[model samples]
Target: MTWTCTECEFAANEDGQDACVACGSERPEEEQETAAEAAENGDDSAPEVVVIELPAKEKLGVKLMPPKDGVIDHGLAIDNINNPLLENKVQAGDLIVAIGGQNVDGMGFSGAIDLIRKMPRPLAISFEIDEVRRQEVVREKFQQNKDNDLDTQLTTYAVVFDNGPMGLNLEEAVRYGIDGAVVRALKGQAKTSGMISIGDIVYKVNETDVLCMPYLEVMNVLRNATAPKTLQFVPKEKLADVQRVNSRHSESFRLRESTSHVKQKLMNNPRLVKDDGNEGDDTQSIAQLIMDNKASPNVTAEYLLELRVDDRRMVMACTSESDKK
Candidate 1:
């Protein structure tokens, strides 16, 4: 029996040589059969790409990151739409593994862009959500547990006794119509699987039912509670929704405005200011301030705060400038 490696197409005719002679790869079980079938039928055309029923890729509105070191596993998630990711699902930190069945890994920034653009629009975009999102979804489902009656039952979490607080903050979980305290921010070291998470609408704490309760009262319940507390919650948004929300913040460079543009913008920048009670120059005179920042290479908040006595006019660095010298 003749065997061929799919990757390097190396022929391994020897009985003991189980791997490819050229690439040193173990041959796939179907590689020989597939090759033989193709040869017998004389069909060398590539397989057609599969089209999945999903939202249009463009309207779905995702921004793919430039491939790094010659590969793109996913793109950064941006929340163009609100908490309804089911409408068009994708999340932050998800790698674009494939588009229209083309494996794009290792195909650096330009390669990925070119391939996607050339491929058909509304192309099937495959992605892997980040680990944080995966855990958040699982915890959300577990917390929103319902019976045949569909009542959300309380879920318990084993609290790891760390110096940190309950890993999550609260907000109004009104969008989903569940009147519970929503999880806002999950603190560092508190973000873990099997614990509370961001976007979880926590409704219970210990014996106290916190749903429909004030924020402070709920906090009090959690603050006084001991370890191994039972805290029930449904996610403020679904897993799909949070993944999109979590994915929305994109990292990109901001263009530096021209010096004249900077001077003009200082009108609202709040960084540059006029002298207190001694209106010597118009607010437009802040052109000098911009020049000052340019003049001193080491100009910083500290340097600006060290105000100099210029004709008895009091200047400020920032919000703390209300104090008169």
Candidate 2:
């Protein structure tokens, strides 16, 4: 006889199986009956199903990944930054088992996403309370804490500048509800000699952590600090791949930003096919090749020649402007 899951109403349970395949609920005892049978027999022993309604227009705010081999639960939460799931105490790496009171087992990645989009406003999301996943999350958090502790010990670069105008361009950024400043540009002495990078995050001013202070307050502190003020900076978080430097600061140009585009352009041309051996060394070797005006199998000499021509034109323009005076 087929058994219906009390939790998600999945009715495809096979005989001899101890759990509902669609919802993972345990099989009912032989003495008990399905919900319909129980109603006919006037039995109230079956568990009550609870449905949760979410706030209006609120989303689950998670990125889901496909399940691994033999995994039977719903999609996995891989990214949950500023997620509404956090408000409900749902964490990244948790298994999303249900949506809108329906079990999500057997649904592939595309099916799960489609269901989420079709779900009513203020979507109801449920997670599987698996002990194994819970323990794994605990261990991951422990490791993250350890990694953060190590990061705290790393040396933070300090930039010392005189009082007037600071000579450093600063911009505010917020992440995970923490406020911090980013180095946008370097001016005057800061541009010529400062060790602080354009993309680094302002960790501290003097001895105060910028993240602890309000964004406006941090700006005010930098604006009103005494002469010979110290600003400590650290690299931004790993996930923050933004490059702040613009064309004026080509000295700080990063190959990472254009790596894919450059590869695509090279790949589009049959004659400029990239060398397989140098694919992994693209960033390092490309920089050296551009500097030397040399071409590898993947890079064309015309590209290097164009760069040289641009440099020459810039030099000629500068010389002509000097002559005009």
Candidate 3:
């Protein structure tokens, strides 16, 4: 009995067959006849497309504030804020304010840092202050720039925690308060300028916590707040390890998901075409296919467990890899 794949239109050979000769699509003889009859009668079914939706739940937020004109009472000293090279003129004890937001006018804290670097200064007088105070001063400078020019550039900081200088340990860094984090795990002399990361928490700026908030909210607070804010939070000790593991797991999950989708597509639409004389057949267990196309080395056992319930091929690959030499 001869048969043809309903999908690729590949026909069976002279010998009685159960699958298409060109593509490894299997079909019972009776089913093939039924499908052929239906096709003769113009009956057809639309192909189904599968869409995988993976939900990402991680969140981070940064807030911008207006500049405040306050004397350097304590903490970081004025000498610290003065960057003649960058032409930053704000000195210790100088009054400044924060500014900028999602829709506000002016640059926020991050932009001020760039200004400092671009115009580095020596012996510039700002009052002595700590890290947290310095952050506030920078925020204020950003606001000042905005007030002076409606076209002032805007910048924000990002908080990130990762491995420290030592292997397997972690550190934290606050980038521009919205672009980076304070890496405190590394050992070095305290920096007079540039990024600061002594311990876990930011020593400068107000006590208004912006961690995990939406990016827009952070911008809104800084742009609209009339007073100085304080943000407080303990640093995560194992943040680096956690992030590394999460990143690896996410990628593995995505790849396995993609492979499963491909397999299902081929199974449902087993259609092969004979363009030339050569036959084309593609068939493999999911495990074999994924191993051949392993996306990363960080895929964990836990990630595999999550895949087992929905992806049989992934489970098979896990078991198969363990049994190998």
Each model's TM-score, in the order given?
Answer: 0.24, 0.32, 0.17
Worst 10 residues of 2 by lDDT: 298-307
Instruction: Give the alpha carbon lDDT tens digit for every residue of 1-325 in model 2.
Output: 3356677776434344576555677877752445446667875443222223456776656666666753446444544436654555555556666666456776676777777777677665555434456568778878887756654654567778775666778765432223457778888767766476776777678877664454578898876677788877776552122222211122322456448777556445545323344666444433344534533222111211112454232111112333333
Q: lDDT tens string, model 3, 91-194? A: 33332221110111144444543433343222121121134555677787777665445311112233322322211112222221211233444432223223
How do the candidates rank by lDDT, highest first? 2, 1, 3
* Candidate 3: residue 180 lDDT (0-100): 20
Model 1: CA > 4 A from native: 1-148, 152-164, 174-176, 194-196, 237-325
TM-score quality measure for candidate 3: 0.17
- Sort all candidates by TM-score, best to worst: 2, 1, 3
Regions of candidate 3 where Cα sits further than 4 Å from its true position: 1-209, 214-219, 236-325
lDDT of each: 0.49, 0.55, 0.35
How high is the lDDT of residue 136 in model 2?
Answer: 82
TM-score of 1: 0.24
Candidate 2: list runs displaced more than 4 Å: 1-3, 6-51, 61-74, 78-93, 101-103, 106-111, 122-124, 156-325
